[model samples]
Target: MSAIALRGPERVVIHQHRRALWSAGALALMGVAVVVAAWLWASSASDTFAGSGCSVENTVRGCGDTVRAFLDTELRFSRAVDYAGLAMMVLPACVGMFVAGPLVGRELESGTYQTSWSQSVSPARWLAARLAVPAVLTLAGVSVLSAFSAWAWSRAKGTYYPRGDWYEREVYGAMGTAPVGYALCVLALGALAGLLLRRTVAAMVVTVLAYVPLVMVLNRVREDLWPTARFLGGDRPGGDAWPVDSGMLTASGRAIRLKDCSGGAGDTAACMRDRGGVTAFADYHPASHFWPLQLVETGILLALAALAVALAFRVLRRRHG
Candidate 1:
């Protein structure tokens, strides 16, 4: 809470936004509470089948009711966690809009930032202070929420109620450093938008517009961030693997489009054989590629953030200096 490492401009920034900071803290605390409560509820529910030797795949004859009850309870918990994950995903855009509108654009639009610059504070220093204070607070808050979210996910995932996967869009970002990367990226983008637009509402809208497309692109290309494992013939990846592509392989090792033979499907297998498709092929990323994918995507986001930060500073200098 104390801006001891921060000097005049930074401390002033913190003071100016004290209420918003406190509200953010309160919200983070509420998120933690929800995650903890749901985790406890799910854990207690899991105990019902501890020694009953009952599972979702294989249920004992008399344990059906008990298993159903546990699944129902776990389903609620799963929903809570999934919702939290979704919130985490949306948080970056929220942060971006706030930074663009009230934090930077309002001051710029009202010409209040000039007052600070006249007080022996360089424009670069003022902007740096604005970025630094929020960056630190945002990083700390998001890291905590993501950690708790990941903990909650670990408890209910792979359970009978709401089956989850690591590669799932809602589950992936919240469970790793990707959220932090996204937040920082959007924060920088927001600042840049604020500086460029110099209008509160315009900056906010532009920030969100920019952020949404970036997220969509990243999500679409996420699987290609790392190398995929290939399986051929009867070999196949595990159930938990993230499938990238699949098709049939010809005898000459050429890949064939499975859809091409779908026109006359008297026997699909026979059609494949006629087309010289001797084996099935698949490309996927196993569970082991989780960290690699996370790291690579995070690295890309951080790189974009750094670029935006540079551009923001450059724009500020050109306009103010």
Candidate 2:
């Protein structure tokens, strides 16, 4: 008897690709439209600044109320862009759930993977195909969106309005190579969860529940990943510093919260001195540290993603080998 021809994982890839084409295309169009709108808005804001002779370098100088109102309008619009960009930052988490749930979980739960296994497709190859296609697409799409977001943010941040800052959590997630790393990590996480749970609803729930804590931990630890600089005896060093911690140093060399000395007897400075405070200090990351922080965070997230992917393959091999 002749043996049946087996295309193995190719069939799985092709099937999934066809299913995702329209959704992926729609997402891509939406991303492009958002970026174009931000760029145009930024351009118009720039023209407003130029017309008023009020560059970021000289925003302090008097510009008429008309110019100020226009600039304020621009700031408000930039805040809207910020909201959209932040939503994009969480796109990976959404992708991760989809990957784990309907993509892999449903197949496993419904015993469809068995059909593929019955063919010449090894469990490992099937799982690999499941992970790779969506991963590639997610990486490409998220990276472009992150770059566009960063560009628009840079243009808007130069305004005199205080509506945004780099250290803001959502802004940080939206701005750099970090979002790419995040997307990859979540996709792997979703894949692993699906493989372990082997149930569509459970895997979907686990992915959603797990992603929030993971993001929170990352944010809490991010500023500490690199050594922060201590600024002493000054107002903040400059415009582009992220103040992580601030306090007054006691004469006995203990640090006390800045607020501890506020609203005390006599003047604030005198009150601080009486409380054994000798100097003020701030531990912070300067604007120059932006890329360093971003690269370090990206490295950490990608490492986590690699670990998740490795474990997922191991789990598949153990379960099916």
Candidate 3:
């Protein structure tokens, strides 16, 4: 039949991916640079710790003045990583926005998609190539950043550089496999948004707006993914434990928040007792739960990404078929 075409999706992918590949190459190089920098900084920080003769047994409070200074010095590197880590955390969203706008949106905006369709590249295959090239690149770049971020944080886990608890949103987003998840999800969503919006700037804006809230929502619900260990009484959990909620349980079995147990007069403990606060308990996740939380979130994000990709395909089929 004359309806049959000459060029396949392979050529369509190659043509669509040339400039995208260049950008991906640039991002890959930047990821490599970040990894090298993180390794060097970690090595220096390790040396600083070794020079101070501080072992894992030495808590932050237990360190001597010399050791404290060394830790502070080590923290400079951690702080750098922290700042860079925020960017890495957001990088996937940024990449998705770019993919949505110039990469995917421009073709739709400028009618180049018709050229591809005319060349025997079906809309589905063209869209698949449009999404796939950037997906691979997004994974590569963000995976490197995620690995380095995880390593850097691991190097500083017991230290004070993290500035807050391990469950902190920024810290959690950058470390582990979560960033890769964010990247893939964002990219897929970007593709779907671009396909729906059919305008470059609009697609970019929509992708970004959609991405930020998803991240925040995931962060908020992440702790609930698995059961946290419950601690009661004066027995403190290990320093690596991240407390999700802490409160006082009254003799009446009512939960009183820790903030509400302020002892105004003399002994705080006595005042707490007077307020019917019998025992205090905390729910926390230990360091061992890091991967579990990370992987669970990753799984959720990946599923969302798959859904978005499927939606993109459906939209393409409906629009072009």
What is the TM-score of each predicted model, taking all chains together? Answer: 0.89, 0.81, 0.78
Q: Point out the worst 10-residue segment of candidate 2 by lDDT.
A: 1-10
* Cα TM-score of candidate 1: 0.89
Tens digit of lDDT per residue, candidate 2, span 1-321?
Answer: 001332557455656556565586687677667656755775676676677765544555476565666666676657756766767767878888988998789999999889888887789888887887778777887887888777767766665553467878877888788888888888899999999999998998898888888889989999998899988885766787899877778877787766776765667666766778788888899888888999999998899999999999999989999
Better structure of 1 and 2 per lDDT = 1
Among the numbered candidates, top lDDT falls to 1
Candidate 3 clashing pairs? none
Q: Residue by residue across 183-231, what tens digits does model 3's lDDT show?
A: 8999998999899999999999999999889977887788899889888
Query: Which RMSD does model 1 reach against the true structure?
Result: 2.9
Could you say which candidate leads in TM-score? 1
Cα error of candidate 3 at position 242, Å: 0.8
Candidate 2 residue 143 C-alpha distance from true site, Å: 1.3
Better of 1 and 3 by TM-score: 1
Model 3 whole-model lDDT (C-alpha atoms): 0.76
Query: Which wins on lDDT, candidate 1 or candidate 3?
Result: 1
